[model samples]
Target: MASLSFFIPALGKEPESIEDKIQLAEELKATDFNRFNELLKQVEDSSVNLTAEQHEQFRFLDAYRLAYSGSQTQAVANLTELVKVAKSEKVQFKSLSVLLNILIISRDYSEVFQYLEQYDQMQKNITDKDLRQHALGILALVFNQTSQFDIGYFYANKLSSDAVDGKYACFGMQFKLESLHRLKKYDEFDQEFDAGVATCEAAKQPIYSKIIQSYRVERLLEVDPNQAISLLNSLYQDVEQTSYNVLITLYKTLYSIAYLRNEQLDVAKEYGLSATKNIKEDDINYAILLLYSTLYEIEKANGNFEKALTYHEVLVSKQKAYDDEKAAGLLAYNIAKANVEVKNQRIALLDKDNELLSLQKDLYEKEARQNRLLVLILGAILLLATVLAYRGLTGRSRFKKIAEYDQLTGISNRYHFNNQAKIALDYCETNAKPVALILFDLDYFKDINDTHGHAVGDWALRAVVKTCRNFMRNNDVFGRIGGEEFAVVLPGCQTDKAVLLAEICRDAIAGIDTTESGKHFSLSASFGVSGSDNSGYQLKQLLADADSAMYSAKAAGRNQVATFSE
Candidate 1:
């Protein structure tokens, strides 16, 4: 058995003394096997007098340390025992913190939240700002990992606000900025970044200064690659010897910027390979996919279609994996959108069906009434017959009007568009001429809805559609495709001509002015063009390819035109 040495707390600091020893034990337990063994040796060498409470604290600490530094099997056993012991008495704050830390480090986010609730309850009587800040910081991490950005932002902002002080404020601000970034509020993101930088500077905090500088590099990648590279060079010089997490982040940032700006295939590939090598494979999948995707784009631009396609396939797989969770959100949104569309279509169809039924019923009623009146006035039967014929003609005309056009825009409805597209496709197939399709979507249309209200969004969408219709050729088929998206089928147009025409349409739509709530705004659109290819494509494929191209345009920067190739 090893002899244990202990430091005694001062006479008056009984509870505080016990707390300090427990905290130390928790921290030691969090250390690695070697560190825990070293700590145990130190404990055995020191002699300290402890009261009943202090003895309990030491026992709990020892169990926790054993769990923390032990194998998974041993850790669980020790933790279970410690929990049993701690539960019998009132749980202390120090013990809870240690348990929570272990849960977090183990990535048990679900349990972390449950522990956080208990921690909050424990803090009810404690008014210490430091403890509150610590609790909130832990809570922020929990919310962030779970994609609860709003709640995470709330706690992080509370911790960062001027009400808090010192290092906690800096950590809170960093977390808040991260939450803002995730939410895609880029303008607000920049504001938060600047504020964070200023706070760190004012506090003279080196850790936060490094963190902010690393974030700056990330932002700089969006707008100016050269500036980002220059900043990274300076940062590397300062932290070249330090193998810290921040250093890893900075290296990844540098690699990303270089990969984006470098035009030459060999150079870009070289840098990308270097980056992939430098970062942990599992940690930076998004960055890795981005690199590969960019390289693929470069290859495609250079006309290496086969190589581009290969990289694209890989990129698609990685993107699917990345978007697996968001896939549900997107699918939910799409399903809701589709359901609304189906409902509207069903209503329209029902209205038409009902109108026909009503008209026929009215005609039958009129005829029956006429038959009755004819019996009374035999001489006026001719007049009644003429009146019935006129009503029938008018009813037919009204049904034609309803079937031929959309009620809202007076343009062709989807039924009309589909019929026309099929006819045009048949014509092109017979005549051996090319037909093209252009798909357009308003960029950030949802943001407009969120900011200016849905009514304004609706008005803006209608205005854009109206403008798009005005730009269409006489023979072109155009119709709205759900909210803020539209499709144009151009018969007798080749790929090159379709590209030029799509650009014209994109520019025209971008120039439209929309006003809502006394504020004037301009909107841009992404355009995707697909023409007849020798690969024997169907209408669905044409539409899908064009939509893919449009998304690419949006990704590259909206208000741009992209033509589907291969």
Candidate 2:
């Protein structure tokens, strides 16, 4: 509601009134860092003495500056002390807010939930309406991050409905739209999208408006990729001009997916790479997940399985870390909540005892029953927590396995194949051992699918894999890298040995009986062999050379092994 009189105050005429100082500090701390620092210096130098409360408020503002300006260690230390000692309720609340902001910035969800419990306890003592709305708005954001979209939506609705200031209203609407998008409440999202954008724009919060726009793009990406790319192109420059790294990464990731869906491989890879190259360690996990996952798909589509595997691994790792952090955060919050409940129960029991002091026997019996109930409830909570933790661990393991192996054939999928291949190649290179790669495709496989239907085709694929697996050595890496296509990486093997193995596998495939598949279909495969000595010891190059040789075999005649010449 107030504004700074000047960017930086002159030598002596620096706003002397405590109210002006507070207003100036609030205005410039987030938007104009240099001026805020100058103002802080002026406040420290001014001869006019301030009351204790005023000094505490100024200290809180200074902490806000520090937290926002990359000096979070000192800011957190200062705010931790200020929250406990500050006399004014507003200053205490502000300090807590800044501390929460720091944790959020660092993506420390566990500590965030821990502090959130403290903030919840203090909320009842806070009388300021705007501060209360601020708390609600931040709660919405934290819940959104923690994937509790329902709770996030509820808080955002409350904040929006009760907001007197446009700032809170903008944030409320922005997160509300996000929750709806994430929750897949598309009808409601479409209904509220325009109004939310208008509210953010009216508030002059370009960041929030752009965020809402990003949600629209995300939805469009699923249903209308062309439109998503067009909209992203429109917003590209504007997003770049802003300091919001989240939006920047999100837009680029969206562009990558949109282009990938549109079959624009080169452009998609470019955007995907650009987005991931700028990722920061402390950037939000949401952005990281989107960026890496999209890149994985893009690389896979572009036929770059090596890069695809790398991206897939990174995505899984990041997602696991994020889930673990969120779980810890929820655990901390629950622990704090349980402690608060226990303390409240004890206080209530003490009050009941004091009230019924004359009825001593009845009071003692009631207290004993209440304590027993408390113990049961706590034990149940602990058991539920243990079960959930076990489920999470198993769930992650299951997810990882599903991602690594093909569901259809139960062998390593393209991602895992490339990963294993790279490892084998690296080891071979280090040990000065030869490595060979074999690429094989089931010739006329689609004809089988079209003539006998996919059921028989699937059987043929499985049978072929079974036949080939019997010939593979223990150290050889075999995987289904494509539909009707497979690869094998053989370490400590020369080109001739690899070609022999391929011929054996090919003959086995041809000899397989097709009666078990319900319809008899003869299977034959084209094989290509490439060695590290010829392909320069790089997996990509090896794959390329083998692929070229495989096409040569296909061109000459199916069901034969061809070796790379140069």
Candidate 3:
């Protein structure tokens, strides 16, 4: 689809379109500056009304420019903030793709894995075929880099399917080639590499073409150095990828390394020199280090002792500089993360302080009213003397039960349960003890509430809580998460023991007579159990596992206990 068009009256009333903006973005993206700042200023100055889709397109464009031009740290920072504003799924997918790629380039695999879930959730809502491919293409790249070859191949190949085609088509093909290479499927790699090369070249994506060449040449170096050299030579011959100087340097460095190993000292030195010439001051530290070391080794092989020594000293200096820079960057990232955490903590504290202040204000106002009533009855002097201490004390205690317990069941409420659950989990975790979390809900609870009455429903909930308390250990944390839902956290209990307890509780509830007098009826509930593996020990984790298990139990049949499946 073509981009929306507008006119800028100040610039000779020149016409501007999305293509014009994108072309400008590409030019600026090659530099270290914030891409499209000029265009951003121009757009802000223009009072053009953009449709929702047009607006979203510009958002995607801005993030792309940032991701392309900025450093990994800057890209991650900007994209993280952009995701919240990218309400459209297409825009969101594009922004997240850029973000995940930044993480990949930074080698933050754990964060990539963490974000896969977010991507999956977002993709589930996106029905646009191209957007789906865009999302899957990012996931495929992540899996490929993480060495999950089978999974990577599935998504990449799926994304490459012709049902979805666009600018991101190369991404799917790129991941397919990479994952196959890592899996050591050489024949498949060769085929995909050739196919990807054609597609990227035909599409005029020189950077993508260079990337394909880079990957293919790596495998060729192992099997046939001559063929690898031929391919690498072609890349340098046609190397208009000044925007991708990193790849050119990397390819050149690898070429030098390969020939140096093959005892072609003179040829290796030539390639090494070319590689060094490609290095930029702002290039990636690892690539710069590799190029220096590759050149250093080639010179050493050629028996130029003085030249080799000079290169060695340079390499050492660069390494230290890189290390220092890395340490500083990591410290900054950590400090930023800590600041966000502290900010959230302050907001929570302020909310709690505000609630307390509101409570105190209410109490003061009530006291003043009481004093005024007393004055109306027995003059101002006597009003001050008349103190109703009991009434004052009673008002404060009225909400005490609400804070600690479920009103209907007289058991712990969600707030108290969660608070105490965390404490119990922490203690068990520290002591190397087992802990199990069991979440359960009354089956057909609404049916009972509808057919019988809310009063009967309330009685049934109380009865269930009473029976659960009977089975619960004194140290166990038990509470109602909400209506018809309750949790029992057992410290020092393993999966089997927790499931056993759930079974016992289930049976006990089955025997509960939910009706009063002659209207007797039995009640049943489904239970879900989860135990910590020690690797993952947290209340929220356990609660989620147990909640999932309970739904499984409900699906199977009520009055049964289920533990989370692998």
Candidate 4:
């Protein structure tokens, strides 16, 4: 089957000419499913008399095509082998693009970094601005995915700054805005996105124009939902006339915004369904899951609890699958961190142990000398014994305190929270009582630090923590999860009561007078509240729901509270 498929392409094969190979590759990409398998077989055949370099290059292109067609796992495997062979064969940038695309598609971030190093070396031998710009864009995407926003911004800014005209500027600026968004630099996000939109419009880049418009719609939904809805309504009409991926993405975005607004659920559902219907089955899993989750929320809001629960179950299952993958990644990261920490601890402990041994040896020599002198042998022995006892006592006490207390806030950290929360959850579950999780975030915290100093920001954070502590019960658990975010676990609190308490906490922070540099100002927060029966509950799920609700509150407007249900 593979031979037959390759035979057709081989009849017209022109391995000597890159253009012919590129054209033929495109033709192979457009081939039907039955023919695709044949093309793959043909590409794998070794009887085509291709040189080693040509075979390696063809394999890279084949893997790239597979990646584009959504065979991600297979594509990654193929690309890994191709990269090995290409490096050995010293393949150039023309072949490098294929590997780059595979890296981006599979999100092989660490490998992408390694490839960037190779790219630097390869660039010294090639001179193609367009190709270089494309590679830079892909690199920016890799950085974005890996949460390296500053690096992504640096490369993206470079691309835009070096563009002769505004031709590639929009692409670069789009990435810049994305980096800013990820970094939580909302001010820069607004500025860059606006500039990108204007440049794309002036350059008549329709695809980018649509993308910027869609982004604007998304941004408007956060700041002003009514305005976003109006903008999306206009775009929806314009987009309905065309069949494009951007249009599908716009539909999904519009549906999500509308759902969050709690306006026009039926319309949102219709849009979501239509969007997925138009996409290929293999390409629509995430989109479908997202849409169905939105639908579930709408159903719950409308009092269709049974239907909502069904959708929620599906979403939970899907989320579990995603979480499993995330957990694996996190496990790898944690293992690396643990290994480094253990290595350092071992070195420190070894030094301390060796120092103690040396001290004992010195004392033993002194005792021997005293015995020889026949005077103070017993005194030296007593002093050495006292020193050892003191060291043992101090080490145990320090270790115990370190295990119980957080280093930063001097409060109970995640360890304490986990133990206490588990106990509380178990009590609530046994009594069939309610449990609430409240997640709160400081608004405009980055701006506060940029305007006031980091010291002032620290002062503000300490103030917020103090204020929050005043409202907590003796049994409640409060902990900082690092960086301007905090969590509170309330046992036996219902949804309405939890929401009310969250608002009170928000208002308390708002009322606090934080004076920095003799300028008195108040800060506000957004809250997400989730309450559950506590039975068969997962703490992580509660956190996730609370986070989603908090984002909803932020989307609605900051300085507010939102409750999660279903």
Q: Candidate 2 — which residues are off by over 4 angstroms?
A: 1-14, 17-23, 46-48, 124-127, 281-284, 358-566
Model 3 over residues 26-126: C-alpha lDDT tens digits? Answer: 34543423535676555545426655665666666566655655555666776777677766766677678677767766656556655666787787688
Q: Global lDDT of each model?
A: 0.65, 0.82, 0.71, 0.67
For candidate 4, lDDT tens digit of each residue in 198-231?
8877866655555656666666766787787777
Instruction: Identify the runs in model 1 with alpha carbons over 4 angstroms from their true place.
Output: 1-52, 63-92, 123-129, 162-165, 198-208, 239-241, 245-250, 262-266, 281-566
Evaluated against the true structure, the overall lDDT of model 1 is: 0.65
Best by lDDT: 2
Top TM-score prediction, candidate number? 2
Candidate 2 TM-score over all chains jointly: 0.57
Poorest stretch of ten by lDDT in candidate 1: 1-10
- After superposition, the stretches of candidate 3 with alpha carbons farther than 4 Å from their true spots are 1-82, 85-88, 98-114, 143-151, 162-167, 231-235, 240-243, 285-290, 303-566
TM-scores of the candidates in the order shown: 0.45, 0.57, 0.46, 0.46
Can you write out model 1's per-residue Cα lDDT over 1-566, one digit (the tens) per residue?
Answer: 00011112232232234345444543444334455455454554442765566555565556555554545445555554555566324335545555665665555554555456557666555466655676677667666655677778888898898335656777778778878877877788787887787776676555555655666677777787778777877767544444454355445535544555755456555555555555554442445566667757667766889988987987787777657634443333333343345456667768989999999999998988868756666757777888999899999988986997676666677777778787888888789888898888888889889888887887776777776665455678887655677888888878876786676567777777665435577788899988777323367777888998898998898999998887
TM-score for model 4? 0.46
Q: Residue 52 lDDT in model 4?
A: 69
lDDT of 2 at 65: 75
List ranges where model 4 is wrong by over 4 Å: 1-82, 85-96, 106-126, 163-168, 201-207, 245-256, 259-262, 272-290, 321-566
- Model 1 vs. true fold: TM: 0.45
